[model samples]
Target: MASEELINARHAATAGLIACASAFVYLLARGYQARRTFYRLRQQGMPMPPWNFVLGHLLAVPPIMKTLPEDTQQPDAFEALCRANEKRDADSIIYLDMWPFADPMMVICSPVLAVQACQEHDLPKPPILHAFFNPLAGGANLFTMNGPEWKRSRALFNSGFSASHILEQTSHIVDEAEVYAKILRQHARKGEIFSLDDVTCWYMMDVIGAVTLDSRLHSQQQFNPLASALRRQIRWHVLDNEWNLLIRWNPARPFVQWYNSYQMNSYIAQELDKRYAEWTEDEAATSSRSIIHLALAGYMAQQKDKPRPRMLDAAFRDWATVQIRLFLFAGHDSTSSTICYCFYLLQSHPEAMAKLRAENDVVFGTDITETAKMMREQPHLLNRLPYTTAVIKESLRLFPPASAMRGGQPGIYLQDDKGNRYPTEGTNMWILHSAVQRNPKYWPSAMEFIPERWLAEPGDPLYPVKGGWRPFEHGPRNCLGQTLAMHDVKITLVLTAREFDIKHAYDEWDRLHPTSKVKSVNGERAYQMQSGGAHPADGYPCRISLRKH
Candidate 1:
């Protein structure tokens, strides 16, 4: 009996050993495959990181937190990673292996390579980004669409933002600016330090609402649904880093699609349904038209010529709401950021602010209403204020609204003016505007807030700065609203500077937190201005002394 038991135990032990050997063999095979793939990529002259069969570069990528802080949040996970990489002078291509079945992903930083990838013909937007921005109501908006669809939709929308149309919106813009100015005046009376960001956001919200929704968003009012929704969406896209993993997994595709659709579409649908019903009942009585009316007119015109393209099944009201939402998202945060940065820089450099005020005095002396009228009557006066224009330009260079992203699928090659080719396959190349603008190679004393750089003569060392100075981006996909944004920034600054002597009450001004699209200062999200957007916590803060013009 003892001998028989020992034989059975021996057999069981042998079986266990065989099982362990099989598992080891399988792991070895996986490691071999991964190594082969890595070496193959290297042989192709592609830049990549050394691979571990299990982690690839999973351990290398930074640990992104699930919940980010409200005040000092990094813009996006990718941006945070880029900043880290820049410090290390790491290779542009990173082999990211966050999950099983994950492909070798590349992160690009070179500008020329980025331009080629963005302008590529064969690449559709990566599924991850597309899933995030694809609106639920119907067809994709300009922000998501790629290739012919993106091109066509862009052209269609381009006409609406033409110079003439922007001019037509100025009256409404000025009215809102006046409201903002009054808000700042109240803060000035209290002799309190305030955030300029908050006030400017309210101003931007009002301007975008007027131009896009033909509605007034009283940003001063607490708990405005539209404003809340706008802020929520921006936070979702800009701050939610966890979405990156889900975006990577193809199995979670349905969930991603549902989330984006539900976030914007359902709310917009409800609003549109209510608006359409009211419009149907009141169309005959109304004379003064809104932006929605203009869009409807354009749609009707398109239909009259050729059967109107049913781009999306969204009702006119829903469509209008979607457009307004996008417009607000695009215009508000960016414009407000630029405005606040301008004030911050001006406050830091009083000489520039004084020069700007002097120019304001020479252009429109001692009368706020007269200045507004003059700005309206002789808009060209805007171009003539070299120092003022320089200030605006410099501010934009420091904080551009849109960060650059390259277009194309993985495996594409991008070449520079030199015969050097970059491996751009599946690369989301970034043109870090902040990094570019601050590069010491491009601007001498690049870190200083110097508006005089723009006014330099052709032969001046600063005048010959490279392509990094672009605020509106360069080439075909550049900002169509460049003229409009410029007009708004110029007028707001001129009006604000002329009426108020601004000062930074805080010991240190905030630095911009890197985000995907919009860049903002730390700890100054919402500020209390005497009379600006509403409060700096809701915007950015700046203390002001109201000047009697």
Candidate 2:
């Protein structure tokens, strides 16, 4: 009787526990369903692509999530997709499936919508999606900051990257360009197949190093660890692979990333401490050459009246580190890619090359050494290179280095050209730069390389379209270092073109891709480049020769 009674009590306790467990799970599922329903209701009026369970639209899947499609490999694939969607519903917001359980994102392709998002309504950046940018640019940096904080941080940087300040540093880029030309000449002598994209990146790194650190990083000659680390961090952040998975799951990848970050942060901190001490110790001895010096001066001037902020040392270090990283990464990569594309485009279109070279000769004169001397002594000559400027402009129009992203706030909306309003709440907005810049309505024969379009008279049909050409973007948050980028590109083009005549290594191109030629941007049966930038997938393999007199 006692054993039977004990068994009965044990069975009752078991039943009680199971009942509680089932009730808890039921409530949890009910809550999840309610949230999902709320999200679906929010997206009721929006035009979205078909979404899969747990994948949403799968558009924002990390690079590791699936095999890259051939169609999606094109640099302008996103723009192409956006164009297709616009045809279906011109006034509707184009939705992109991010991760499941997250808000769906919408892309803004129209200039009117882009301008409205940026100017009239201040849209914040999407949260968590831009985590990749956090390590390089901290939360406090201009890229990550919002509202009043961004304005304050941006103001300090303006002193260093202003038009006048950038022009003053023109000789610095000219000197860097000379060094780059020497390296290219060596490669030309060997008749080697080198990656033009890689070489251009190295040259731009050296240029940025000189401007920001006031030191020749010598990255072109020797590999710099910081530069390597920065590149690796970005590579890992974007391209997820076995190594990146280990980075998330295992300790080894994390260690490598941490070490690189530490090494870079330590170097920048030491440099900041040394420079600040020098400035405080001696004013006359402090040569204000680098952006670091200029920004520090601005900080000091601003802080003189206001009370010292807390943790000023750490804050300034972070500020300087972000700026250095920005210049090193964005400043270098964008301009270098632009330079590589300029060469690639010019090689394909010999007529454009001839026109550019003629302009260089007319403005810079035929003597290469004399031109170098003038570049060093007369920086103002850069302003007179109008056709060269136009060439760079047209190249940028074809290939914008980066696109703009804006997060929608409550009550903020986008309007179509036909005056249709699209509510933006709970949606992320991306300004598709490639689509906007290449609109056929604004630019006739948009895919063709035509530098003359920029030189057209005001009343002419080929005249510069108002608000149509935004290579560096537009509005308050446009690229801060645009002037600097343009200056570097112009200097590199002039000096390099003056010394070397570049030609595409068509044999090597065939060897790299033995198959049929794919249609490039302008429906031309040319080497189809599959990349996010203007460079080819295989990189621009080219032969170079000293220009015949």
State which candidate has the highest lDDT. 2
lDDT of 2 by residue, 146-208 (tens): 788778767766777877778888777877788899998998788767778778877988898
TM-score of each: 0.71, 0.83
What local distance difference test score does each model get?
0.59, 0.69
What C-alpha lDDT, on a 0 to 100 scale, does residue 212 get in candidate 2?
83
Off by over 4 Å in 1: 1-53, 61-106, 119-124, 134-139, 221-224, 235-291, 305-320, 457-459, 464-466, 505-542, 547-549
After aligning candidate 2 to the native by TM-score, how far in Å is the CA of 518 from where it should be? Answer: 8.1
How accurate locally is residue 483 in candidate 2, as Cα lDDT from 0 to 100?
91
Superposed by TM-score, candidate 1 places the C-alpha of residue 417 at a distance from the truth, in angstroms, of: 5.7
List where candidate 2 sits over 4 angstroms from the true fold: 1-45, 50-55, 59-75, 88-93, 101-103, 239-252, 287-289, 302-312, 506-536
Residues 1-549, candidate 1: write the lDDT tens digits.
999999999999999999999999987776566556655655665544444655665554444332223333222343345445432332233333333333344554444444454444334555444444443223455555667857855665676577776776677777788888888889889887666666677688778777666667676544556666555444434222244565434475455544654655555555444444554467663233454555554455556666544342355545555554565666676777778778877877889888998988887776666877777676667766888889988877655554555544455666645464555553345555555565554578766667888889988877725455655666666666677787788889877887787765443334333344222332233222211111233344456897765
Give the Å shift of residue 343 in candidate 1.
0.7
Per-residue error (Å), model 2, residue 62: 14
